[model samples]
Target chain A: MKSKTLVIAVREYLAAVKTKGFLVGLILMPLLMGGGVLVQSFTKGLEDPTPRTIAVLDRTPGETLWAALDTAAVKQNSGTQVLSVPKPRYTLKHIETPTDAAGLDKTRLDLSDRVRRGEVTAVVEIGPNALKPRPTTTPGTEPSEDTAEDSVYFSTNRPALLEVRDFVSRTIQTPVLAARLGQSRETIEAVSKSSRDVLASRGLARKTDTGVSFEPRSNEAATLLLPVAMVVVMLMVVLVGASPLTTNIIEEKQLRIAEVLVGSVTPFTLMLGKLLGGVATSLTLGAIYLGGAAVAARQLEVLDMLSVGLVIWFIVFTIVASMMYGALFVVAGAAATNVKEAQALMTPMMLVVVMPMFLIGPLMNEPHGTIGLAGTFFPLTAPLVTMMRLTTPPPISWWQPVAALLSSGLMTVALVWLAGRVFRAGFLLVGRPAKFRELIGWILKG
Target chain B: MDDAIAIEGVRKVFGDFVAVENLSLRVPAGKLCGFIGPNGSGKTTTLRLIMRIYAPDAGTVRVLGDSRHGPADDRVGYLPEERMLYKSMRVGEVLTYLSRLKGYKPNRIEIDQWLERLALPGVARRRVQTLSKGQTQKIQLIAVLIAKPKLVLLDEPFSGLDPVNSNVMRDAILELKNNGTTVLFSTHDMASAEELCDRIVMIYKGNKVMDGTINEIRAGHNTDTLRVRLANLASNFDNLPGVACAIAEGDHHELQLTPTADAQAILRELQQRGPVELFEIARPSLHDLFVRTVHEGAA
Candidate 1:
């Protein structure tokens, strides 16, 4: 026969998982996560294969800007060599037109129809003084700057069209400024490259028996995205699992059912059972979210960015984190008289579980810095902060994670002991709800 | 025979308030004992102390020969006053879980038998929240008794129950006693206590005021009061000899006799003055004794 604690744990597990809410969470979690990847890929593939034919009506030195736009497009396409297919190519067409307002209006009307019919993606009209610098003093007047009047007109409301417009403006503006400088094209290019200061970003290099060797810098997006995802999943599981534990205990207390239960089983056994149930709840939700994330990463071809070591750490951290938070939830639940009372009592605990969220960005930026190490040592934030550090380029020392795991495990045991004392006294308490001081007194007395 | 439950000098205090003060009561093995008291009379507190839900300030409680302080023994069963089960769980599941907690492996056949016995045969698969209030109470009762424990402590089992359900519970308690299970129940419902209890223990102001068989306690009061209901009686009913005082009741008169007066002698004199419809020597009831005992203790 199973021990009473295991029986209670199994009962709590089955009771929660069989509910309709669990079923909804089970189905919706994966769909919501998987849909994000599918939508991004779908939009990327939807770009029209036929090169978008853009009509350019230039008044002064339009040929130079058109050449620059093609060059930028080639550079961007070449960077897509990692993918199986090439990016959408742009073809710029020069159209002849008078530089007067009426001529511009007529040309626009002619091109707008082609754009509407999908024959052209956009029309760019360069102003009459496009390549000339504005007069510093407007012919015997106060000095003022002149803004460029270049315009891009497109018919479609698609997002890719917006991207194309941005590319065209950037391509033209670079050369226009170069023309204004009155320098040769080669001199202008050399000056533009050397004038701007760009910071070099590199991963940490550690000393080894073979001398210094640098680890490759992690992908910036993956480094931030993975930890943020893990933090979010942790927060969600804690909230979902812990709140129900509080409500369940309060229900038993208010209804006086706990009095009957404790008569059959010890308060410690009952509390341990509840903590185990909480672990099961959190693990179920963790599996769905983590599994969805893994599938999404594979679909996006970024699975390699997530290592086997990081996955192992994530699993260990989730279990330890769940136990710590789960015990607190049970303690709060046992100490409360009602649902409202339970929520009010759990505020401090909830804050502890979510404090790591605010530190996620800093931890990702400096995975081995003081802030990260501090959070890793704080028992409440250790699991998530350490997991975040593991996802970074630099590997954390083995002792840090091992110590964090042990700390969390010890904390969980202490909380279970604390909750058991509270349950013994508070479960049968009548009249007003006991305050935090009284609960502390119970713990001390126990 | 070993007493099923024995509490000695059990005292419990919460904060500055004394909930149970030097209270001790016992139930002999295989007897249906009623714990009688008004609200806040420490009945529930004393039961909690016995079940080890709360440690007594200065006392010892033994149940089924185990007195060590800890969780309740598996041989004991307790039915708390308020009824509660997991609202989302099926009736059978709740029963199974509770029985398993008491170290019993309750199979489907056993669960169905208890369900049928409680007249809740078709509700084994129904969620507890869906059941009526009376049905829910019955389910809770089954959870308490499913272990077939040696000692059963039920607190206010019949409170809020309708007549039919109350009878069902009353019968079940009697059946449990017949099966050699020692039963201790606390309630303010006097008539149920009078009807079902083989022995009655009454507490007041956190102390044991009266404890004995119902007849023994009643006989101990020895009020020597007689109740006579007359269809046709003389106007001077108060003038009868040996009647110290005459208190008029509805179509009857309660007479307190002198210490040396005989009840039969009063009946003989009353027969000459009026037609005697009914005549009985009054025995004090548990309710009457409880009120007088609490009031006397207060004074």
Candidate 2:
């Protein structure tokens, strides 16, 4: 950089970094994110843990089903105590059922009242032939309500009690299956245990000189979280770093300081200086956040999850995205005569910066899919989408990252050059802000 | 002496509006030149062209003997008509930053000295926004001159300044001239232009209507106008011989002479009419010249 540009950059960087707003933002972002998690955990610990009482009405003409359900609930409740936060316990209360249809309707009405009054958590009604095998229906055909004898109805006022519903549904399946097969409980248990198979996913094993070594079991959740986390962090850095350039430039122009500065240095130099300054500020923010994350990950023994190669890639993308967005923001500032106009011009650019976030899920699902490849090649989205692809399973080929870097780097240069032209033409422009068409004209003509 | 600034056949237009047309001018080194014109008459545009802030559509602008097209070299400084500075920065920091851009490493001492010279002592540490309007103007002037350029261009340097601050600014510009620095400034204040400028350049409607030293410009115009004050308050010179026109000016009357009228005869006629307390033939003031030039050009 030229001495003049460097001087301007130093001033720009200090001007932004020294502000109280910057400090507040720097501290507030992490606090908000961490505080959200802390608040959620604190609220969870305060949940009502009283065992939910479920009323059961069995019309299958047998008392064995209720007894079996009671035993299963006891076993489940015992097993939950070993965990850090015990699961919700369920207590079954058997209700007598009548043979007549009118009596059955009355019993259901009483149960509905009890559920609504919060006297019981839910009501489970077993159909008269719940243990019987379900009739097979042809494809695309449905069984009529009157004929669906194997159905069980579970009703509750609270739709969000999914865990309670799932527990009851799982616990009653064995008892019903044994009754329908007319087999003893032990025999059914043995058969069920014999036929079950558990599937576990693991990373590919590599062959060593002496023997083949197996890789550790894959944590699917962590695998998905890493790339998403990287992309989120990158997006935050770019937004924080580049968004301020527009306001700063607009302020300088509105204050009429731009003309004085341009009198000393060319408009291009002034713009480039500010761009570098913004990039530097963003990198500092990223380092602070990522460094804290690294320390925490190390303490949790998950540091290996963030490989050195991935960290380097994060830095590369952050710089590229910052430059591209920063230059465009500078142009927006130069073309606008006020903050409102600057914001109006910056909306589209902001959308482009954040558009990759919406595509992250698809890009992670298929790293080499059409959308993923398009995002990787399109300069604007490449930094974010490519970071997501890097962390997802079925890692992309080595050349993909290299190609993305090249394409994005080239685009950044082109944008900076274009921004310089617009800045030169618009820096001294005073009065109403330029229209989009006029801005394009400046870019083309300058 | 070499010309500090030289523009040859410069033409600049914005859209369909021609801001400057076929203009050429030169200012000798170490001379103080006043650029005078009506608003929107292209004085600012010409100055920007010399500073390379605006490139001419068709022209060559050479400043400090260098003609390369880019930002003006470090030897030239400019203070725009609009007074502005970074309101958030201290006065000293802004000065240092601007000075560095010109390749001058200004120290705190140098900034303080410039501030002191502009009658702005102890303001180096204060943010520009905190200063009064006059103080801000003085700081802006110091920002331009802190680098000690060979040539300085000021646009409306006295626009918003109080009389005291204007004197301070005027003294600074005179000091620059005495130190062999070329100064070119534009303003509507004709008295200041006449008192301070060694030569004046007047442009009207994008054309140079007059350009010369003060004496030369006055010598070029007709100097047959006479000022007369009489003891009789009802006296008038409308019918006096060889007087083409006459107008009352407070207690005095100004008479315009026909080309062939004699100054001695006009004086004698004024004395014979009444007790002439004062009588003299005088040249037109700079204010009169400016008004006449603009009016005639408009016509």
The sequence of per-residue lDDT tens digits that candidate 1 reaches over residues A115-217 is: 8787888877666566776555657677664544543233443446666787777777667776776767678778878887767777568688999976455
lDDT of 2 by residue, B1-299 (tens): 89999989999998899999999999999999999999999998998888888898998989999888885578889898985888899999999988888889889988888887787888889998899999998888888888989999999999998999999999999999999999999999999999999999999888888899999999999986888889996887766878999878887888888999887877787788889887878899888899988888878
For each candidate, give its TM-score against the true structure. Answer: 0.78, 0.85
lDDT of 2 by residue, A1-446 (tens): 29888998889888878877668768876776578888897777444677788898877766556776778788877765534766667789999987788998899899999999999998988887888755667899887554434667889997687777887778777778787788877888899888887565665687989898765544455676678778877888777778888888888877788878878898888998898788877788888888987897677566777789888998999999999989889888889988999888889888988999889768766777999999999988888888888888677899998899999999999999999999998988878898888888989989
Per-residue lDDT of B196-260 in model 1, one digit per residue for the tens? 99999988879898899988998899776788888775545667778899888787778877888
Whose DockQ is greatest here?
1
Interface RMSD of 2: 1.1
* Ten residues in sequence with the least summed lDDT for candidate 2 chain A: A214-223
- Candidate 2 deviant stretches above 4 angstroms: A28-35, A45-133, A136-197, A200-221, A393-396, B242-251, B256-266
